[model samples]
Target chain A: MENVILRDVGLRDGLQLVKAIVPTEHKIEWCRRVVAAGVPEVEITSLVPAKIAPQFADAEEVVAATLSIPGYLPSALIPNARGAERGFALGIPKLNYVLSASEEHNLANIRRSTQASIDDFGRIVELRNETAPKTCLAAGIATAFGCTIQGEVPEARVYEIAAELCGLGADEIIVADTVGYANPAQVKRILTGVMKEIGDRPLLLHLHDTRGLGLANMAAALEVGVRAFDASIGGLGGCPFAPGASGNINLEDAAFLAEATGFATGIDIEALVALRQTVETWLPGERFAGQVAQSGLPKTFAPIHRQAA
Target chain B: MENVILRDVGLRDGLQLVKAIVPTEHKIEWCRRVVAAGVPEVEITSLVPAKIAPQFADAEEVVAATLSIPGYLPSALIPNARGAERGFALGIPKLNYVLSASEEHNLANIRRSTQASIDDFGRIVELRNETAPKTCLAAGIATAFGCTIQGEVPEARVYEIAAELCGLGADEIIVADTVGYANPAQVKRILTGVMKEIGDRPLLLHLHDTRGLGLANMAAALEVGVRAFDASIGGLGGCPFAPGASGNINLEDAAFLAEATGFATGIDIEALVALRQTVETWLPGERFAGQVAQSGLPKTFAPIHRQAA
Candidate 1:
């Protein structure tokens, strides 16, 4: 394990954005490729209703197939207590629960009020503690920076939510720029404030490249001591709720950034680059954006994992 | 004027890579529109031979037309002493002279050794001092980070060259990732070393978005107190000499990053966004890469110039 973690959310986040339903076997293969590329963790699929997101109708099968793969942590996005129950029943080791920081976004996304979601989140935590003590529960604060529906989300509200989630037994907390509305200054400010409010807790960041600040925001967060980030392979995933948001920061690019900035990610970038070809073939005509894919790795770049091996 | 400088190099750098030769009138209009967008500086053209870079055939005419526009400092790329003489004769205010930090890149780029380029740079400085005292001589250290030809460039060589330029009475020193081979760690490391060696001199940065670290590299440079950056409108310009290189960082996105990070760029982002349309029309079929153009400015984004006004 390296000091930094790149949690690949391509299957859950990436697939949900695409209309075409990728075969469950291909989703399983995607997991295997990323893990073989030395990614330690992956959010394999989301336990959402099949009707709501038809692309992820085979989430259960994906989780089952991915869990059989060795040497990688397979996780899933649990939208509510029901999803959490399903994941627990399936014996998944990690469940990422998301709640929007803005009330409007929460209402629009999950059709629930902010307080109602928090109450449900607490129930999910309790269920996790009772049913699967070994499972890690991560609370993701979506739209933590700003929301398209509500415009500017106050940093105070984000900090308060972070404090609340920390108190509510979230083993990990993630600050997300859901609509890609964050800049480096805002990222540094929010990360610093939330870290001050909840001392020494494991914090992760999920940034969208909607306005091209994804890697720059990552650099700012790294400057402020953030070591974990959520990324989607081939830069997949966009906010269907947000009007003009782009996609998640490219995982291979994010891993390349981390490693290039001297943070050991244990990711094999060449393998990730190769996997991108398969992804391209799987989703024909879908545009994938990343620089390493076009320019290849710098000659000076040496993967720490390869060196160790 | 704002605290940060977004010197648009689109006309010079952007058009140079483009195969189509845009009319001189359109090039002049590009300069005027960018200036109206509140950019403080623009590199309007390059004084290179017409046979070598036919796209810049009207360099002198473009400079003559753009210098008539007020508010923005009009500059040009001066490849050698002859080009410097032409720019000075045209009364272009700033002449950006390129010299590669790697000997291999210098020989390949300009058919001269690194030491010869330095000597030519000194001659250009002397020529400006004796003939046109008002013309600012800027020494651009290309491949300051790494080179496609030589692979990894030693930081000491960059520092040595930067210090030499400062000593030789160059008005400005620019560290360029000519092939876009830089990561943030290398950026911070190189910038710190050069700044320490050449204390308190005006240092600018020219970053290529070749591998998509352009904005990220810009943020790293900004974190270490670098304020001036070279950007191309619509992410234009790839090195005709270097293989596998992309374009300069996009000016609109660069301005967006600067303003969002609380640095006052004085750039009217909306105006710039509109100008991108004109650029697209001017260079039809050319692919321009930037996020701000794809996703309009965030709701909370307030242009610093608009705020000050």
Candidate 2:
């Protein structure tokens, strides 16, 4: 059975837009619970100024707590070279950098132009090499599908940005439908184009379920050979730029898709669903979305490895 | 842009499970509104006895009203030869017959064996030939993917049933995920196999959104040249046998998917959304599901025909 990597970004992307500042201990518990469910990787937090996103004020503390977990592969989001430096100084093994393909969304989201963010990415790569040589630098192009503000993001622009990121020595390339405006056909086309530019570098998809096409897009990505994806527990993480939209694809549902389609995710769906219940109790007023938790896994469900055996 | 036929089954399948008996006039209004939204065909009602499904007690009145609408192709579901005779007597242009691929589900749903249903279908075909030769006979195999009552229905069983129906003179074949257990890979495999048995006959997929894989399965079906699908307005419909599951795939979402993926659906999405609002007012207690109604269409959304123009 083929295996795919599902990275839970609940701590970083999921909590960023949240109003309530979860305690460092609770965030650590979240990391611990998701890891116990056999998630291969986790994005613990973003190394940004406390004032920008008060919810992630304890980023360093969260990172320290996650590093204490044995055999856990933890990553952090880095918006610029400064954030990269923070991650490097903390000895984080993976750092993800994101820039939007849509100009309006990039400026609105990070207060910089797309080209400026691209240039910053180059500097971050250099910083990673000089300071944390063992660190993996993953460059993610946000709004690779389309943008709520810009309306239409050209396929060529996404390919061009990906090629530039690759030239800047990125260890991996990630394409994100930050606003969830992607369809399966568009997902296949853009990922196919991005794959051509980035040869054999590991690729991941970060998709949102804004229009209920997230899993469908994931299926298309799988068909095109993308083996890694970013999902959030209970479908957490809404884009502040796209209003009236749901969050990222549900982690349990993504694992279910992987297994049901004959791929091994190594993640226990029942455990994730139980964790989601705990998460809902802790978060209080936040809106969560996922079907597997409500409907339960199908009776015939068996992991790909089990089916193979 | 290639064209696909979207048949709205809200009035028939969608209302069948509802305890509330929607007024006959309202059902007529639904037929008129959906046709105005450019839906080419609609399954307006089932020809079963009112004692069986009281929600469809006014089936004849609904069909009569729908047939009065200009250029609208209306179809009805018939469970037995008696139902088919009623449809023929009414001069209905199309009739749909459903049998389960799972023997257990067949007995539980229609209170008969799979072989008996097939035999009844054969008799219905002979009756249609004698009384209404121009009427199109669409034979649907429910639980074709997997079953809640009987898990893991074999692929060969589905192919065999489709072949038998074709030999029995079925005008079209429909593969249904009645319990919403289909994955995209299985959808592709089963539909590919069924297509080989029923060559050149029109095929439609009736899918449910129970597990959130409806559109993904639809995408896979489209990849394999399936152009017709069954959807419900506001995603109304549920399997009594599949507890805790959501309804059928949303009509607006399905049309949005077809248009977004470069297929021409000729559906006015905004109009369908408006009708969904009206539907909600009419059926206050029923739970409805759809994303396009909540998020609104993407800013860049243009139907395939308009994109080509």
Candidate 3:
């Protein structure tokens, strides 16, 4: 867990939520700061039709900027094989292939059924192998906990899809609670079973605080040996897939939790709070999320664990 | 758990964080609104020195006003036996007792050692038995998780103090993550052990999202069958006890999580959100917390568990 990598997705996921369109160059600058921070990985942009998400119109440019930053793992989201192809062509570090587990969510979010999306995932895997062998392919099964279109996603279905994603040659399999309905016990229960089937695929926990269980679910996953987590800087990206849900785990809060406890994720809390100042200036209309950043550290704060030892 | 009482400490615990003194009448009016919203229990005020917290200088008067509200189980903080006497005379339904678990925290917060505080608890218990027989007494083992002053508070000591409190005739024990240093696993491990020693005395979880594990802790406590919780509206209070930590668990977020995870806390999410508007007008500078308040409910948001039974 000490080696866990927290990828800051504020540039892509954070920017995606703003109603006001950020300039492509400003988006590039967002990528620059995150890359400069030397976070092990970053989801720099989400590739979609420009009209739906104007904030991410310059996905190509954002990926290109990330490509320029060495030692930073640049990644982007692709909705289909086309998005996957575009991402692979960039010579970036990773491509996140996302699909909603609920059939209702897939139809509403991507205008495809669950199986259709799974079929497309096969193309994505093939695209990665043919076009970008070095580019890591991670499948994010969104709404793994439950969905807005269809509530209470079965644990067996999530486990089955994870196994299939692994069989399809996914470099990593991420179990996401898109609507944030998972409790820690439920997270522990599901992940305990899911890990058995997924074997050794680097399982990622993509959690939302939609129902205030983001960090709890993450903790349960960590207890079961999950070290890879996907979070948004300033808890940006309320939701591209679900309307009323989008804020990922706030990077600063997660860092504080991880560092305060016995785990290590090399996130500087004060620096992360500083990063939110930039985000505040960029996304003025959008309300930033997190408690530690707002309330500040405890007066008698003791950092029991060392970082990057 | 649906029948379990949730005590809102927004007025007493929440308001002290903001330095700006809200007018006494306005604070009183908000207390009325809180009670009208169907909250069964509320920690309306604390009997600390007025000089230290002028915001709560009217705690006695506030308790008087709170007791007037029909069916309100009004509670107040008494640092020692004297504060309990004041609350007892007022005929309030509950008297909350506090003693810090960390030796340094006890000194800094209440100017007492662990043994001395325990001795005081015995005296307070005796006083309650002699005078305030009608008042429900709850002893809070503050900083049971960890402390800013002494750092890691031992689990054995926490369990011992909980048993001691129960033996001293405390009606219920409040386990607080004062510094927000507790994670989900720790919350579960500690609360489970404490419950065993204390028999059936109800355990109330008082959490702060300071380090973003408050809700995570709640989920863990839920696993251990400790149903009741303490939250403040807009996550009020800035660790006046510990200093520089996050506020209490925002009531709206806690209610949202409780309902989302198939548990009913009997809080109206929309009503809770509406309640924050009143606070915004009063304490504008104070950073009130909660994510669900901003995001609203998921489109697929259905309280299936709440409806089924």
Candidate 4:
């Protein structure tokens, strides 16, 4: 069993994309069900301004609720230093902070320049060190492959930023296809460069299925030795900053791909498939995407062995 | 530029699934448009019994029409030795012959036992040798990954058949995920074995998007160095013999993935994207699938350079 980590971001990334703000209670149930489905980690919410994105208004409550699910790690996307402080205060073991490789997208997404975002990441790292030394801070390099506004992002620029993030004490470096513009060649090339520059640091990938290359990119990342990936249950996501971007790679599908390809994701495909029904029922007409949901698992599919949580 | 071949199977595989018998003229137009869109090869139609599949009643006409398209090779599916005689008699350049790796699927599909299919394949090769030595014969092993009926196709089984096919002088040895049950790992593993066994034979991949792993499987195949592939326009196909089988991989999406992943497919993605509209209109209410059609080409896409064809 190859060791691969599939971190579910449905509660955070998926919910944010929905127009109808799901109640906090439903979010908790979604969290519980996904954790029970064998996902080891879940990005429950983003600590952004609730005023700007009302869908994630109950970020704190959602994180708190997910923490109660024992044996599963809970994470939150912290947009800036303020959000990092909030997440750290809430005792999140891991906090994902994002910066865009494209200057225009960085400005458009977080209302800051590229350097400003880097500075914020440094501050967030310092805050984590001071307040919660045990917290793992992952710096996600968004739009690392291509940007909707800026188009092709240079691979050199991504490596330079990844090196900086590594030097600034970021525990993990994540290459994000913010607009889903990455192809496998780009993924392999970028991850090869980013990994080379940030030697020995854990590298994760965040992908969107905007152009339907999400899982392909994930497979490329795996080929290049990336073991961690961010996926959303039912393929629910859309970046408000990056227009036309679809959902993150579907969690169940990602888990299925990983496990089927001989990587042990510790996920129960049948459980996830069963839970997907509940999710579809919960979010009617929400356009949940994934094939295993429609085609069901193959008879040859063997679910990962659970260690009895 | 990486040389990857995308063989369009929209005419043969896609239409065979359609209940309506597409007019011969429309089929001719589709063939012309797809060839103009820059596919190097097109599987024109299946030389099967019209009583069995009425949609391909115009098989001979379509093949004759497409042979006029300059700079692209034309192929047709030959189910048995008689079909091979028909194809070779029509002066087709290449003939694709399929044999199922799953014993159950082979029996169900062509109504022949595994040994009987192999014996038939030998006869087809003899016919090709006698009639048109210039015509290339490709042996496609369906259910190479998994089968709907048998499930979990052993890699050993695929390699054994591929080795036998190679011994029989197959110009190309192709692995087809007949039921789309392949994951990237399964693809890599099986292809690695099959390629090793069929050393130096032109190995191609035929994938279905049943589990949404079409592009992912393509990337995996690419990783393992498979250069030729079978694709259908608008992701159309439905295996009548296999109960849960879906369409072949989308041609435009396959081209997009191949080109995007740094392989020079020689496909004008813009043209293919545009032609997809005509296909949609031609088959109104048909469930055409592919992400590139919905999201358009990305800003980073660079169409492969065509050599004045």
Candidate 5:
């Protein structure tokens, strides 16, 4: 409970941009290997319409298969009440809901106004309460740090949004570096203010490795007491600026840093690396980023695993 | 002087790994931009014979052209006495001499024995004393942390080699993560011991981002009074592991960090980014690595360029 809970997002964020959609069977197996290697939670897919996110058409199937494992929570990204309702029917315990802070970004990204998104969030909470009472709703503020379209999201605006989301009965507030435009100072300043305004809710950080500050930002967050992190196995996410130059922060490498810094992540980095090799070879031509995965853990590294049990 | 002088190694280290050799004129212009951006020093080329490093056949011409720029110390990597003599005679004031620490790497990489390398270093020092008395020699111990051929180089061995180079009259000692196998803990452990043995002589840490630990290791070194670093312009150095894994710490980004942390780095990042555009057009095939180069600095980050004189 004192340590961080890392959520592997490769299956969800990593496959979003790829030309080849990984088969459901292979993805299920990939999930199994990473979980076996000691990853406690995973974001398996976004609940987008199959027409748009063909890679995640099998999101329901993955959730059903992954739920059978003990000590593992399979999370899915949902945009509206409908996706939240669909995810609840499929029985995912956690729903990672997202909204954009900028009015310009919200309309461009989700085809809804920021005010309209707030309205939709209120209904999604209502749907959650009626459909599945126990399902935890972790609301993510995507591009809360900045936006490519509008640029430079003010900290006050982010704080205002987080307060509104909390008022909407959201249980968890996660700040995301959606476009990878955040520096560590920006992350610290925003997270500091947001946590102060939101007050004691589960504050999670979802950072992108855009501009290569993913890990550095995580380190800043770690110093300030934010423990839950969102990362992809082998850093598989792509850059909206380009295709995949904006890789997701690699989960195995993140685990290595957490453990290295005397923070317990309950992850075996070598096992994660082994799991990543299968993922890499299984899906050729998919861009993979992470230093520890490329060069195995240093011979001197010692991990403390199984203590969490 | 307190800020680390990170020499941009792309022209030599980055270009060496690529199959195509960049033209001499473009390289000279690149050097001009580097000097113009207030990069006080640079590793322009490795002084290996034209047969070995034909890509740097223009080393003489490059350094000679760089000498025309005032207040910039252009350095060369001298493998043997002949390379050292060549660099010294060209009037490039500073020379960085290197040899692999691991016996296997020395044999495989340079085709010389470790003990024989020590003997050659002694001769090179003698030659420098007679031929060019004012030359600054920085000794780099390659594979000092680990080796690709023989994994897990002992910390004791790294300390011993770093000590021997200083004893053999080498001006400065460089502890390099040549194989990209160093962790921050390892960097701290080895460098602390090396600093204790080789007192007050500046130790330059040449790190690779292969495992994304390049910046992490730099942070660790900063805690231990290390102020001199070796970095490339675009994180352009190739991963000895292969092509496409371009893994050098980008100098412009590193300068941003130094200035961000309130340390004094005599570099203008805006000018450096402008210089980096020169490479993007020249080497379209090259995979350049740098975060600040892609994402412009936050409007708030105003770096200290120089004293108000």
Candidate 6:
């Protein structure tokens, strides 16, 4: 059976929009529980300053706590060169850097032009090589599908940016439907092109459920042979820059989709749902989305590994 | 551009689970508004006895009211030969008949064995031939993916049922994921096989959003060349027999997905969202689903027809 990697980004992305700060201990526990549920990777925190997103104030504590969990690939989202330097100082195993394909969104999100962000990404790669050669750099193209501020982001621009990032020695390329404006056909069309440009490098899709096509988009990517995704538990997290958008595709639901469609995720869905419930209690009044948590797993469901056995 | 027919099943399937009976005048207005929004067909009501489903008590009135709308195809669900006779007597344009592929689900839902329902469907076809030759008979195989009561519904069994229904003179065949147990892979596999069996006959997919794979499953069907679907306004219905299932795919969202993916649905999404707001007020305290309603249409969104122009 083919295997897919689902990286839980709930701690960083999910908590970004919330008003209350989730305790650092709870964030660490969240990491521990999800890894126990067989998620191979977790984006434990973002490397931005507390003034920008106060919810991520305890990034160091959260990242440090995650390192103790054996066999877990802990990662952090680093927005700029300064953030990358901070992540490098902590010896983070993986650092995710994002630049929007929409120039308007890039400027709004990080106060930098798309070209400037691309140049900064190259500098971050150099910094990683010099200070922390072991750290992995994943360059994410945000608003790669479409943009709220600037409508109709051209698909050709996405391919060009992906090729440029690959040339800059990035370890991985992540295409994000940052505002959830993608359809399955667009996903198939764009991801197929991006894959061609970044030959042999790992490709991951960071999708949002804004318009209810998240899983459909993921399914389309799967058909094009994308086996890595970034999801959040309970479908937490939305882009602060994109108004009226929902959160990432629910991690439990994404895992369920992978297993149901003949791909192995190695995730225990029940455990994820249980973790979601705990998280819900921890942050009361926050909106949570996903179906498996409400209906529970179908009686016919079985993990891909078990089905093969 | 590829064209898809989105049949609004909101009046029949969407209202099936509601405890409060919606007035007949409101139902007529719903028919008028949705047709004005460019939906080609609608399942206006079910012909079951009023005592069993008080929500559909005014089936004849609803069906009659829908027929006056220009270019609109009005249909009703006919559970048995008696229901078909009621539909035939009213001169309904189309009648949808369903039998579960899972015997347990068929027994629980319609209180008949699967074979008994099949025999009854054959009788309904003969009745339509004799009494109402112009009326279309659509045979739907429910629980074609999996069953809540009986897990692991075999794919071979579904193909057999579709072929049998086709042989029995079914004018159209519909494959329903009654409990939302379908993944995109299963949808592609099953719909592909069913399409082969019912060559050149019109096929429709009846999908549910019970597990958040509704749109994803629909995308897979679209890839397999199945262009027709059954969706509900605001996702208002669920199977009374399937305990934890949510509702059918939202009509507005389904239309948006079709338009976004280069398939012409001819639906004005703004109009549907407006109607959804009115419907939500009508049925106070009912759970409504779909992201398009919550987030509104994206700035990049364009109807397929407009995009072509």
DockQ winner: 6
Q: Which regions of candidate 3 deviate over 4 angstroms?
A: A19-38, A49-54, A149-160, A189-197, A295-309, B1-4, B19-38, B49-52, B57-61, B68-72, B112-114, B150-160, B299-309
Cα-lDDT of candidate 4: 0.86
Error of 4 at A42 (Å): 0.7
- The i-RMS of candidate 4 is 1.1
The TM-score obtained for chain B of candidate 4 when compared with the true chain B? 0.97
lDDT (10s digit) by residue, model 3, range A82-157:
8887777777678888888888888888898888888889888887888788888888888887777687787888
Name the better of 4 and 6 by lDDT. Answer: 6
The lDDT ranking, best first, is 6, 2, 1, 4, 5, 3
Model 5, A265: alpha-carbon shift in Å? 4.7
Model 2 lDDT per residue over A1-309, tens place:
788889999998898677678888889999999999889899999998888888878888898888878756899998888899999999999999988999999998899999999999888887777878999999999989888999999999999999999999999999999988999999999999999999999999999988878899999999999999999998899777666656889898899989999999889899999999998988899978877887887777887652231
In terms of TM-score, how similar is model 1 to the real structure? 0.97
Off by over 4 Å in 6: A306-309, B306-309
Model 1 chain B weakest lDDT span, ten residues long: B300-309
Instruction: List model 1 lDDT by residue over A11-120, tens digit each.
Output: 98787677678998899899999999999889998898888888878988888788989988888888899999999999899889999999999999899987788888
Rank order (by DockQ, best first)? 6, 1, 4, 2, 3, 5
TM-score (chain A only) for the predictions, listed in order: 0.96, 0.97, 0.93, 0.96, 0.95, 0.98
lDDT of each: 0.88, 0.89, 0.77, 0.86, 0.78, 0.91
**What TM-score number comes out for model 3?**
0.87
> Candidate 5, fnat value?
0.23
Summarize candidate 6's per-residue lDDT along A199-237 as a digit string, tens digits: 999999999998889999999999999999999999999
Instruction: Write down the RMSD of candidate 4 (Cα, Å).
Output: 2.2
Which of 1 and 6 is the better model by DockQ?
6
For B1-309, candidate 3 gives per-residue lDDT tens digits of 354456788887787678788777887887787776655678888787788778878876776666787856778888887787887888878888988889898998878788898889888878878887777889999899888767778899999999888988889899988778787767878999999988988788888777777887786787678888888888887676676677888887777667666675555677777878888888878887777777676554554333222
TM-score of every prediction relative to native: 0.97, 0.96, 0.87, 0.95, 0.83, 0.98
